[model samples]
Target chain A: MPARADATSPWRSVLAPSWSLGRGADPLPTFVWPVASAVLLAAAWSLAAGRFDVTVFPSPLAVAREAMRMAADGTIWEHAGISAARLAAGFAIGGAVAVPVGLAMGLSPFFRRMMEPFTEFFRFIPAIAMVVFALIWFGIGEASKLFLIAYNAFFSIAMATEMGVARVERSRINAVLSLGGSRRDTALLVVLPSVVPYILQGMRIGMGRAFATIVSAEILAANAGLGYLIYSAREFSRMDTVVVAIVALGLLGLAADRAFVAIARRLYRHTLPEEFGP
Target chain B: MIRARFVEMVLPYLLSVAIMLGLWQLAATQVNPLFFPRLETVWRSFWSLASGDLGAQILVSLARILAGFGIASLAAVPIGLLMGTVPAVHRLLGGPVDFFRFIPPIAMIVLAVAWFGASDVAIVFLIGFSTIFIVTINTEAGVLHVVRNRIRAAQMMGAGFWQVFWLVVLPSAIPHALIGMRIAMGAAFSTIVSAEMIAGDYGLGYLLQEARTTLRTGNIFVGIVLLGMLGIMTDRVFRFLIDRFGGEHAGSR
Candidate 1:
């Protein structure tokens, strides 16, 4: 596939290049449109919020104030930090377990057939729905949250890794074999590198799951995360705080996605073409 | 001796199911029922629920998903077309779309409950929220990917703006729009459970949440297994419909 027009130049703008795809002739710069749009949206939002009681719907300023207060008092860090930790932990556990399983499945048709049923069956069960199961298995501890997030991450990573393994060039594998290289050598040297892009894409998706599950994982659990923050704040109609938490979650998700891509770009150095890769 | 086809194709499925269930049943023998219910007990619970309101509850949730997703598709597709074809609309709405889409639907539950408060509207709104941007963005992508020369060719043949849209533009995007709908529908399905848990008194999500508190592992399994079936069946039906209708263009873009 042809690389995107913007691919040759990285960091052409603050926003990711893909976001600005397919509209090149605009008179305004990229940042101008978003900023202008934000202003327009903020005005509308402010007016709408004023019509409601502030408790029910807060103005953007109110949300900003809440965010600032949370930041100043270190409340935001505590919650965000814990949530990030849980997300990272779940991501690590899921990746560690799924990568090897996916490799096995891709390498051997027998393993794929054996595992396909469970993967297909269980993937349909959304991770949020399993909050109860996680709670039951791990109690109200951190383990429940971790398990729920990790469970969500597991399928995507596994499937992506398996597909990535399938994408390895037949000739490459043949070459390795014809050179009298061992199966382990082909798997480690060739299969592993070729699969990195797919795995990274999977992990990005897994990151999305982790971000989403913050609400489910923190629900009915003890406390101390962004989800808990939202749930707790909602009890008293703390709209500002709720909005704060929601924005934090969105920004966090976006940041996590970009971080994955940036890291992938640095380590793999253009392995991900714009078309197939996320 | 077993036939090669049966051994290779059939055995893995049967064996895997057997092993997974056998291990679960074996482990359940040693654990508290709360942690792990036996397969037989779960089977019985499934029957009990199935014989009762389970079907009706699923229908209720399904109706919400359809209504919500249907409405979302209606609005999103046009807006997406506008974004693709008209630069002004893209500039106006692009930022909000990017910001809103990334905020997962689950995060919206508390606010939805706060605003709509145990109403069907809340659940429907969340379902719509979960899906609208996806459909819109995908539809936009479809439009963007349309070959420019095709539009030029249509114009050269004396096609006007609306004519060109109907003839050249909209048809090409249907497959992508269908793809978006498929994905958004799945998102809608999952969103229903969460929405119902917070807003509705009935539905699989409610049942699951209720069973969680009531400590009915059997009922919980029933909820999960049924949800899986519902998800898979919907996906298959949607794909089949798309393939049947849009066969020529199903995977073109």
Candidate 2:
């Protein structure tokens, strides 16, 4: 039999300076566009807000100074940490439950029939609409906020998992079954392995949804977390703090997403190139 | 077989609602109206809201969503095409764009409130920003997915960069862009209510929030339903466009 391709072979190329644009490849242009766009936006804001002479539209410099002060006091970090914890907790809970349910639904028609309808129904309904119920079911606290994130995460992840499992080639399943493996064994050993790539992809997308939902949940309620911090800053008319929070949220979300992509590459080393290549 | 499949989809949906309403009706007999309103009374409220001033609020919310989504598509697609066709450009901006994409657009609500002062502009900005990220990413991805071999073929035939891009790349990327636009439209609509909740003089989100505060459960239900229906309708419109223009050439790579 032919030897299986070594998994570690590609990482060497990625890490080594084998590629022309190697490790020092700077995403500076990406940064510049958003920043430039933001500045242009800020300028536009100034012109528009300047007309009213209202304090709410503080100069961008004022927002920057307030950002620096929040950084000095470490208040921003604390709030960010709280928000991150909520995001992680929700992601963990939703991912764990949805993965298994997705596997079961994919494997059995009966389970899929019983569950898919209910899931899809709720899935189409906006997460924000569930805010009222979250407040009622879990009360106005961390649990409610976490549930909202979890709610967004679970449906997307489960559907991904189900689709992933279902999409695994029947040939692969038959190959395992022909080896005298039971249905359960073939599913666990053969189908599950192939489905990890899809699961990871789903999780990446879910991270986007969950991240967005968490902010809305926090805004609706909660005293801590980044959303709360920003809303508080707004109430105090601290445009700087608001700017900082906005930058912080954007940066944190981008970082988390990149981290997820990196981990996905590390996990599914062999298929990464062909699957995602542009 | 098609009939069976249709029944399979429809029956469960009907059953779930029946079960939910039945439980709600039963629970209302024991629970307080403020916390848990009667299902029948809620139905009555929904009817009134559907027929009254609440309908205008729904229109306001829908209009804002359409305006924001329309603006996002106009701005994002051209820039996305540039990034996708140019590797050097993609290499530079891809990293920063990916990072910020995750930051919940919700964080911008504060800035929205601060800068726009709870007006239509602020709401539009929030919707536009959220939709723009997804549209940009998808547009870029779609462009990348256009077969490199095809581009080379076009170039061999003396196609210029712009010609190769417009002829080969843009057509291939449309479906993905449309998909992203669809998702973004949904996201924009979802956020509109919340955005409106803050400083909205009128809109479904404002109305829903108001109904909740006023203890009008039925109106809240109506607002939620109207929003969902609008979302579904928008999705259908996008689907129709994709069918008409894209013609399944770019459905889902």
Candidate 3:
């Protein structure tokens, strides 16, 4: 399949440069260095733990044990699952609304001018700052957490969609129209397909923002999730549990990002026009 | 013609703000005041706070962001330059940098609080730690984009490596570094807010938390609006600096 060529395609920009850089590297040294550094870091941490106060900074082994215990009892899974579900629902809700609104904005100059300032202003407002407003409006329920995540994701997706649509090739649309395609057909088949990669790029960024917001929201006002786990453990001075929660959050973020990459790859494979042959 | 064009350009923004305020007022009247304060009430609170405690909180948050962002920029720029210029250094540090980059700064609040004990140092550490990776990566990217021919020309002119790096490479990379610093500033600003909400006593984040506890929706709105304004104002300052210092590199990209 042929990928549409555009200077503003973020996915292409992110992936293209790295591939060329990786070609000449020896794989063995590459693997050895990262693993060696990981081992070195662990050794250093262990040494520091032995010298310093364990209450403040637990050993790597202690953290591993805590993680195992959490896993054995399924507590870690419960927290992780709740956080993941919230992230998914928020991304879905935000992306669904943002794409259509962004399309309208991209297609109509008047609409774009009307919405840009308001959205831009809100975009600068940290999602963390909205926790209180969310709490007041939605209370200390799942709604508040979801709202925070969705709000953060919405602006990112909307901006990405608008840019993507605005950058869609005029020639492609003209060709479609000359081929007897209606205006609606040109929008659905030509413009939307061309902008899919940009929308996906936006979703990727939005997912990261949503994860960050969820952590803050949970810390501020939640009974569950990884943020809550870390906060509650900290309250009791459980440094080991805190480390375990941090590691868990990192791993979950990595997993979700990898999942997104895989899904995006599949979508690109199916949707990219054949003329821009891959 | 020019006047009409200017109006056409500006009218939508004004109309949009008006429409939003109108809708907000409409909603306020329908909902309970506790949940959604009237627009006028929120506006009054905004004005009062702007002249009082909000100014102090804004200063506190700004100080924290600057401290953290300043430290991150100082550390990241040199290291990023080294990584870009030296292959061995990049290989040695790239893995760890990428790993830490995946872990959001918000997740580190727990560890930060534990290590630094809810002090300004903890917030600074959180912001700095989160920002360093971004600045480093962007700096490296910027350095990599520097025209190799220019460096070779400097070398051919009998300039030492340090001289070439300081004079040729550094100037070319400044724009990207500046962009990274702007991004880092934004990140630090938001991270400090979250950190404050968790452990602070006097920042805007703390004020928002306090307002939430007191069920003062109007005060919460004030805090949010103030934060938005602060962000916009600081961003404008960065844009001005970038344009002033970046020269040909500022908007060329």
Give the per-residue lDDT of model 2 (tens digit) for B103-217: 6776787767766666889888888887887899889888877777877788689876567666887888898788889888877876786777655788888887787677676
Which stretches of model 2 miss by more than 4 angstroms?
A: A1-65, A272-278, B1-13, B30-36, B91-96, B247-253
* TM-score, model 3, chain B versus true chain B: 0.93
Per-residue lDDT of A108-162 in model 2, one digit per residue for the tens?
8766876865675567667777677677667897788878878778888888889
Clashing pairs in 3: A1-A278, A2-A276
Q: CA lDDT, every prediction?
A: 0.81, 0.73, 0.79
Q: What is the lDDT of residue A76 in candidate 3?
A: 96
Candidate 1 wrong stretches, greater than 4 Å:
A1-25, A268-270, A273-278, B245-253
DockQ of each: 0.46, 0.36, 0.42
Which whole-number lDDT from 0 to 100 does residue B40 have in model 1?
90
User: Model 3 off-target regions past 4 Å?
Assistant: A1-28, A265-278, B152-160, B245-249
The pairs that clash in candidate 1 are: none
lDDT of 3 by residue, A1-278 (tens): 01222334433332222212222434354477677778878998899888757678899999889889999999999999999999989888888888998888898888999998878789888898988878778778888887888888889888878888988889999998999999999899988887777777777777766777888888878889998998888768888988888888778877776776666678887754321223
lDDT of each residue in A111-205, candidate 1, tens digit only: 89999999988887778788888888887898988898889889989998998899899899999999999999899989999898788888887
| Highest DockQ scorer | 1
CAPRI-style class, candidate 2: acceptable
Task: Tell me the interface RMSD of every candidate, in Å.
Answer: 6.0, 7.9, 7.2
Residue range B34-135, candidate 1, lDDT tens digits: 688999999999899989988998888888888889899999999898777665567778878877877878788888877787688888889989889989
